[model samples]
Target: MIRCTGVRHRRLTIPSLAANARQIAVIGPNGAGKTTFLGLCAGMEEPNKGEVTLFGRKPSEVRIGWVGEFPDRTMLFSRVYDEIASSLRFRHVSCRESDTRVHETAALLGIEGLLPKATDELSGGEKALVAFAAALVHDPEVLILDEVDSHLDEEAGRRVADAIKSRPGVSVIACTQNMDTAAEADLLLYIEEGCIRHAGTAEEVFEHLKETCFYPAVWRVRGC
Candidate 1:
């Protein structure tokens, strides 16, 4: 479980959103502090007034895997295979097992052919895949994603969704802008002005939000 209290980032004062081991989705308009809130949850930033925790443990106490919006930044090694296999090798995984894990993740992400290619040479989407491969190799208890779909098309997005669903015991928290993305979410949070206007299942919040927020009316209801 992760928690935030009196969370303030720069000018945004976010309320404490406690995640008690369930999957959560954060959504709202751009600049609504969704990413900032996620950063705090991921322990990338210190809060202005409150604290964050993971199951009564700090983020350091719990292993965290992340796929940032720009994945190329996570790449360090010369070759894609090296970048993917680096952590596994560091953990002393057997050579045969490490190769198998890397190839398996690559095939799952459709980047197997790029194993020998330089990490510096892959496209943005391909780099995203490699970064994802690296994150999943260690299999952390929690995965935090920030706008991971920016560069992906619909098919790529589905592949990611599939990967997320098949995993077990790993809790996921994500910040996204796509309403369609919210449809796949089990728990959805609608944030407005850095506070939660609503937090519930995707259907419960998303359904009513359309009626509450003002939009150009298409037709007049029978009310006069």
Candidate 2:
């Protein structure tokens, strides 16, 4: 869970985004502060004004897993299993436990067969999933994914969705451009011009955006 109030950093301003929603999907055009918002949520960056809290504590004080838009930025190991286990190694987890967690997380993300592959040789989507597995390996309290599905195909996206849906205890906040993916979230946030234009159920937000310039015509015609 996360909460923010008048959070401002550079050109972005989040009036508020209440916590407690199980899964939140943030959607907006490019440079709409989606990534900035997630960074603030995960404590990757500081806001010039206002406040941000996760699970009743500041973002920096909480345990959170972040998978950025670029997988290569997070992948340091050559092997898939090693990449996922790197975090556990940094935390000084036992070798046996790290191995178990790495394999389990890979299987959950439908990438178990890739355990022995070379991380640098993976496809774009494969790299993303591996990065996600790394983030999830430590079982952080919250998971924040920033446009992680951008390069993923439909099947890959489904696998990501399944992994998120299966993790009930981990609060998820995902930012994406895909309307269909946003539609599947328990809560939807429509941000425009660095502000939260709407925050509610997916249908409610979609309905509010239907006739506006923000909603994609293709998705609107298909009835999101």
Candidate 3:
């Protein structure tokens, strides 16, 4: 659903990225350009060097839901319900449908009780869930999540993972340090420095990890 050719921004350079999988995981070390790469795919940032296209259109023109590493960046409204409902409201969805979608999305992320809470009062993990809910409510064709589950606990993380996995038509490209989450993805891309060092199945990427001496968190998650 997405393609990048010689995509470069700042220090990162992805020679090529042809992501056709419905669920793709971007696993990499700190400062490995994972977020930069995601921004290119989301059309949030334009590459100074190459091209990135999503679903045959520019990333900005495509319908996509994105959640960044920081939840606060995604927050605009003060209330949780309004935050999740914002997307639907922007599209002029009926109030009844918007309300239903808001509540349903909150419930899916196990944050039903939080619907009445204030956005500023939520914990970091809670805010993350809210941010994710906001992205999911509109049912965008592609979901770009940049290390969104980092602050979430194991259960919350699984909830997020399960929710994304259940979406039949939405393609997801998540950048995560959580190897267990990466392991569940349909495809894996291992990035280092500013390049995609390897792009393949989980096993194939892990094989490449075996050759490296660092043995990062992803390797630990794989019991390597």
Best by lDDT: 3
Residue pairs with backbone overlap in model 3: none
Over 1-224, each residue of candidate 1 has an lDDT whose tens digit, in order, gives 77766766665665667656457888887777777777776778877787777877767677777788888876779999999998888789999999998988778877789999998898887787778778777777888888787778787777777777768788888877666665566788777777777777766776556654311122114221
TM-scores, all candidates, are 0.84, 0.92, 0.91
The worst-scoring run of ten residues by lDDT in candidate 3 lies at 210-219
Model 2 gets an lDDT of 0.86
Clashes of each: 0, 0, 0
Model 1 CA deviation exceeding 4 Å by range: 89-96, 211-224
Comparing 1 and 3 by lDDT, which wins? 3
Q: What's the CA RMSD of model 1 in angstroms? A: 4.3
Q: Give the C-alpha miss distance for residue 195 in model 3, angstroms.
A: 0.9
Ranked by TM-score, top first: 2, 3, 1
Tens digits of lDDT, candidate 2, 32-142 = 888898999899999999999988899888778899999887788899889899889999999999988998898888899999999988999999989888988898888
Could you tell me how far off, in angstroms, the CA of residue 10 lies in candidate 2 after the best superposition? Answer: 1.5
- Candidate 2: pairs in clash: none
